[model samples]
Target: MTHTIRNLSTLVELRSNEVEKLQSEVAAKESLRERHQKTLDKLTHLYESSGASGRLPMALALNCGDYKQGVMAMAAHQKVNLSMHEADMAVSQRALTAAYVKREVLGQVLEKHQHAAVTAQRSQERKQHDELATQLWYRGHK
Candidate 1:
């Protein structure tokens, strides 16, 4: 019984540590998600402005000697912006999924811990009851 109690205590401590680690990871992911969102927003604004401005300046800046080269540079920049936007969306989605999974995992761990504690308490109570009953029977015999 003493060993069982000790093991339960150890398990509780381990679970607590795991929960803390998961919490930290979730926080870090959230921070990353926020940063990614900001980058995505900035990229969106840049893309909109570039479109409004006709993107000629960007093409000329790229040293595209011909109209074809200029157009290619503009196309490349647009493609890059689109790719970044997609990547940001993916990262945000993953972050959200991680958060949900972490919460669910934590909930399950807490529920398991509660059940273990309850079972231990009930077992201890039953042991005490049996001991008391045994003592009473012995006293009556005496």
Candidate 2:
């Protein structure tokens, strides 16, 4: 029985480690996604603030238009990349949640096994104590 408890504890520890690893992976993914979003925001801001004003000389306005077009294309690409990153992050999050649940279940099982082992030990001790008390009473009476 004690050996069984030991095996259970080992399993619980393994599950805990798995959960921690998955949590770190999810956090890393989340951080990457946030950075991509910031990049996209900056690109959009740049596209809007490009120097395409009516007061610009004709040649300069033409150059600004070309720059705007390039920025727009880059922004589109960035958005697609951001979408892919978000999808990956979502998958990682799901895996992390599942790991957390499995770890908790294992922990609960270990707790139950330990409690049963302790209870059994105390029961055995109580029986031995009761027998000793009865033997002393009988000896004294005789």
Candidate 3:
């Protein structure tokens, strides 16, 4: 039983490690998403601030329009990419949570096994001590 419990504990530890790995992956994806979002925000701010200017050469204005269109396209692409990363992070988070729960349940089982073994040992010791005391009392009285 002890050997089996030890094996189970090892398995649970492996699962915990897997959960940690998944958590790290999720964090990395989140970081990537944040970076993409920041880039999109910067592009948006630039576009908005550009509109504040009142006058421009007609040729320059047409060029600026083209530049703004390009920036908008890039921002849209980044937004879509960020959303995909967010979805991946969510999936990893769910998997990590499930793994953690399984490991915790196994840990509780391992603890129970140890506790039961100790309780049995103590009960046996108490029985032996009671028997020995009773024998000594009878011998002394006789």
Candidate 4:
């Protein structure tokens, strides 16, 4: 039983580590999304502030249009990527929650086993002491 408890403890430790790794991955994905959003915002701001002001050379107009189109495409792609990351994070969160619950249950079982062992030991000690006291009483009466 002790061996089983030890193994379970080790499993719990491993699961905790896995949860940490998943959390870090989620953080990284969130950071990526933030950066992408900032890039999109800057592109939109720049285009709005400059591209709408006046007519330019044909070449310059075409270049500006291409730039706007490219930024829009990148924004779309980033939106999809962000959703994927959010989905992944949600899945990881669920897995982490499950792992924590399992670990908690195992810890409770281990505590109960320890408590029972202590109770049994105390009972045995009490029985031995009673027997010794009874023997002493009989010897004195004799």
Output the worst ten-in-a-row residue range by lDDT, candidate 2: 49-58
lDDT of 3 by residue, 3-106 (tens): 86788789889988988898888788888888988998998887777773237788888878878888888888888888888888888889989988988998
Can you give the lDDT of residue 133 in candidate 1? Answer: 100
Winner by lDDT: 2
Question: Candidate 2 regions off by >4 Å?
Answer: 51-55
Residue ranges of candidate 3 with Cα displaced over 4 Å = 52-55
TM-scores of the candidates are 0.43, 0.92, 0.87, 0.76
Candidate 2 accuracy as lDDT = 0.90
Q: Model 3 clash pairs? A: none
Tens digits of lDDT, candidate 4, 54-141: 3878888888788777777776777777677778768877876877777677777777777776787899999999999999999999
The digit string of per-residue lDDT tens for model 2 on 1-142 reads 8998899899889988998999888888888888999999999999998865567898888888888989999999999999999888888888888888988998898899899999999999999999999999999999
Give me the displacement of residue 53 in model 2, in angstroms.
5.4
Whole-model Cα lDDT per candidate?
0.63, 0.90, 0.85, 0.75
TM-score of 4: 0.76
